[model samples]
Structures are given as structure tokens and as C-alpha cells.
Target: MICESFPVGPFQCNCVILACEETRTAVVFDPGDEADEILGSLARHQLKAVFLFHTHAHLDHIGATDLVRTKTGAAAGLHEEDMPLCENLHIQASLFGLPTPPTPPIDRFLKHGDSFSFGKEKVEVIHTPGHTPGSVSFHVPAFGLLTGDTLFAGSVGRTDLWGGSHPTLINSIQKRLLSFPDETAVLPGHGPRTTIGRERRSNPFLV
Candidate 1:
């Protein structure tokens, strides 16, 4: 398994690229922006993206979904609960004073406990709401977890946005995130990476 993550878009959302070295097959997670750059990275890695996944439909997270899909011929997926948010991409962007980008049609709907594989690597999808009703985290047990906006390095995601709930976000963290091994690495949607144990023991929001 090969994994790389970088920030993109005006909001600097983290876009992750995970590939199976053996098969050269990959999945792009949270393609927030910079479709050309993302494609370039994929090309450099000799990867053929099979799927483009969004942890939620937030504009900053799915900004380049259509462009990427159109270029890579990859299927796009998002949680069904975030469909409304996905459809309201333009509105969300406008709220942030950014130009609206086209929202791509979702090719598949992801749910809790769902899993997918590329060559020898497998990823598990865990539904974790509260940052947004459809926010999810992807766990690749051997590598790390791709936490959309649910859990940050030393803080949790903000709940003041549409469909966000503070209590629910906390619950999602305790139940979904804390359940993992303490040493498990966390690749959040934005900011630097951290370990589950670090956040569990010291994250002010969690502690």
C-alpha cells in the first residue's frame, strides 16, 4: 500500500491518494481542489484511480470531484446522507465567499461497515456524523485512518455548520474514533497528522 496526502483548494482541505503498489490501482479521498495537480500526482505514481471518495459533501472537500472524475474516468462516491449537501455545493461555496464549483453526480453511496479493496489493500468505511450528517472516516487498519472533519490533531471538528451537532460529534468520536488502537495514526481532512492515542489522551475536546 502506498499513501500520500496533501492540502488543496482555498480552504486547504487534505486530499489523500492511496494506491496498491502491486496493481497500480488507487483511490482518491477528498479531492477538494487542484484537479490538475491531483492528476499529476497520480500520474507520477503511475496510478490509475478507480474511485474518488468524499468523506462528506462539504464544498471544500469535493471541490474538484467532477473534474477529477471526468479526467480519470473514476467513479465518485459519497454517503447518501450528504447528498443534500453535495447538491448544495454552490450555496456552500457562496457562503464562504468562494466561487461555486460544479457538483459531480455520485456513482455510489457509502455506508458504515462497507469495505473496498485494491490489490492487497483493503479500506473500511465507518459512518461518523456530526461534523455534518454524512461525515465518514475510512480506516485502513494497517496504515491509518482517514478522518474527514470528524477528528483533528488536537481538536474536534466544529459543529456550528449546517446539520452539525456538538453532542453527536462527541459521541461519534468516543464511539467511532476511540475504539481504534491507541497507536493508530489519524489522517484528518485538514492540518497535521496525529495518533489516536495522542488525541485520546490530550485532545482538549476529547479529554
Candidate 2:
């Protein structure tokens, strides 16, 4: 598997592109903004995007969802619990005084335990809510964990937004994320990468 992550948009949301070297099929996580950049990455990698997966429906994480989907013909997937927020993109943008972009229709409803493959690599969905009711983390056993706004380098996600819950976020981190192998790489949505053990031992919120 080939992985690339970069910050995009005004908020600097981390967008990730994962591709299978053998088949050149890719899965884009959080196009966020900068459709041209995202598309260019795909072209540079010589990979075809087959799926666009969102960790949640937050404005920063989904700003260019429709644009990317339209450009690559990739199917957009998101947890069913976040549908309401996904549908209210305009309101979400309004809250931040940003212009509203067209909301993309969900091509697939993601759920806990759901698994999908791109070439020889597989991605498993772990429904880790709290930052948002439908927040999720993608686990690629051989690669790493994509903890979108869930667990960061020395902190955890903020649960002050719509459908966020502090207790639930903590529970998800402890029960769902911490259970992974200590060496598992944690690729969060907004900051530097860290391992499960590193977070367990030093993350201010988890420790």
C-alpha cells in the first residue's frame, strides 16, 4: 500500500490518499479542499480513485467532497449517523462564515466492521463517534489507522461540535482505538502521526 497525507483548505484538514501499488487503485480520505491538488495527486500517483471516504461531516473534512467525487467518479462513503450533518453543509459553512459548496450524495453508508478492498489492501471501518455522531476511524491492518479527528499526537478530538459527546469520545478512544496493537500507526486528521503505544503512554487526554 502507498500512503500520502497532506493538509488542505483554510483549516488545514489532513487529507489522505492510499493506493495499492499492484493495482493502482486508490481510496481518498477527506478531500477537504483544493480539489485540484487532490486530483493532481491522483494523477501524479497514476492511480485511479475508486472510493472517497469521510471520517465525519465536518465542514473542513468535506469541503471538496463533491468536486473530487465528480472528477474521479469515486463513490462517496460516510457513516449513516452523520447523514444529517452531511445534508446541512450550507449551515455548517454558515457557522464559520464560509461559502457553501454543493453537498455530495452518499454512495455508500459505512458502518462499524465494514470492510472494503483496493487491489490487495483492505480497509476496515471502526465507528468511533463523539467528535461527531458518525465519526469513524479506518484501520488498514498492514498499514495504519486513520483516526480522523479522533486521536491526535498528544491530544484527542474536541467534542464540542454538533452531536459531540465527551464521554462517548473517551469511550471510543479507550475501547475501540487503544485496543489496536501498540505499534499501530495512528494517522490523525489534523496533526503529526503517532503510534498507539505513544498515545497510550503520553497523550494528555488518554493518559
Candidate 3:
């Protein structure tokens, strides 16, 4: 497994690219913006993207979904609960005073325990809502966990946004995420990477 995560767009949301080294097949996650940069990275890596995935439908997380899918011809997937938010992307963007782009059609609605593979590598979709009604975390045991905005390095995602719930988010983190080995790296939608063990021991929101 090969993986890279970087920030994109004005909001600097974290975008990740993961591929199977042997097959060079990849998956793009949370392409918030800078489709060209993301595409460029794929080209430099010599990887073919087969899927685009979103953790939620927040404006900053799915802003470039349409463009990415167009450029890579990859099918997009999102949890069903976020469909309404995905459809209202324009409205959501407006709230942040940002311009909105058209959203791409979701090829699949991910559910808990759902799995997909590329080049023999598989990722499990863990439905861990709270940040949004449909928020999810992708766990690839060989690589690391792609945890959108749900859990950050020292903190956690805010529940003030649409469909967000504090208690629910905590519950999701405690049950769906912390169960992973403490050493499992946590790749979030923003900020630097941390590990489950670190967060479990000290994350202010969790501890």
C-alpha cells in the first residue's frame, strides 16, 4: 500500500491518494479542490484512479468531486445519509462565502462494513456519523484510517454544522474508531496525522 495526504483549496482540506504499489491502481479521497494538482499527483505516481470517495457531503470535502470524476472517470461514493447535503452543496458553499461547483453523481452509497478493493488492497467503510448524519471513516488495515473531519490530532470535528451532534460524534469515535490498534495512523481531513493510541490516550475531546 502507498499513500499520500495533502491539503487543498482555500480551506485547506486534506485530500488523500492511496494506491496499491504493484498494480498502481488508486482511490482519491476528499478531493476538496485543486483537481489539477490531484490529477498531477496521480500522473506523477503513475497510478490510475478507479474510485473517488467522500467521508461526508460538507462543502470543503466534496467540492472537487465532479471535476475529479470527470478527469479520472472514476466512480464516486458517499454514505446515503449525506445525499441531501451533497445535493445542497451550492447552498452549503454559500454559507462559507465560497463558490460552488456541480456535484457528481454518487455511484455507490457506502454502508458500515462495506468493502472495496483495488489491486488486491481493500478498505472497509465504517459508518461513523456525528460530524454529519452520514459521515464515515475508511479503514485499510494495511495502510491507515482515512478519518475525514471526524477526529483531528488533538481534538475532534465540530458538531455545530448541519446534522452534527456532539454526543453522537463522541460515541462514533469511541466505538467505531478507537477499536483499531492504537498504532493505526489517523489520516484526517485537516491537520497533521496522528495515531489512534495517541488520540486514545490524550485527545482532549476524547479523554
lDDT of each: 0.92, 0.94, 0.92
Which digits, one per residue and each the tens of the lDDT, describe model 2 over residues 26-49?
999988999999999999999999
In the predicted model 1, the residue pairs found to clash are none
TM-score of decoy 2: 0.98
Q: Model 3, range 1-207, lDDT digits (tens) per residue?
A: 888788999889999999999999999999989989999999999999999999999888898989889988999999999999999988988888888889789999999999999898988999999999999999987888989999999999999988999999999999999999998999999999999999999998888
| CA lDDT for candidate 2 | 0.94
lDDT tens digits, residue span 65-94, model 1 = 999999999999899999999999889988
Worst 10 residues of 3 by lDDT: 95-104
Listed in order, each prediction's TM-score against the native is 0.98, 0.98, 0.98
Rate residue 183 of model 3 by lDDT. Answer: 86
Error of 3 at 27 (Å): 0.5
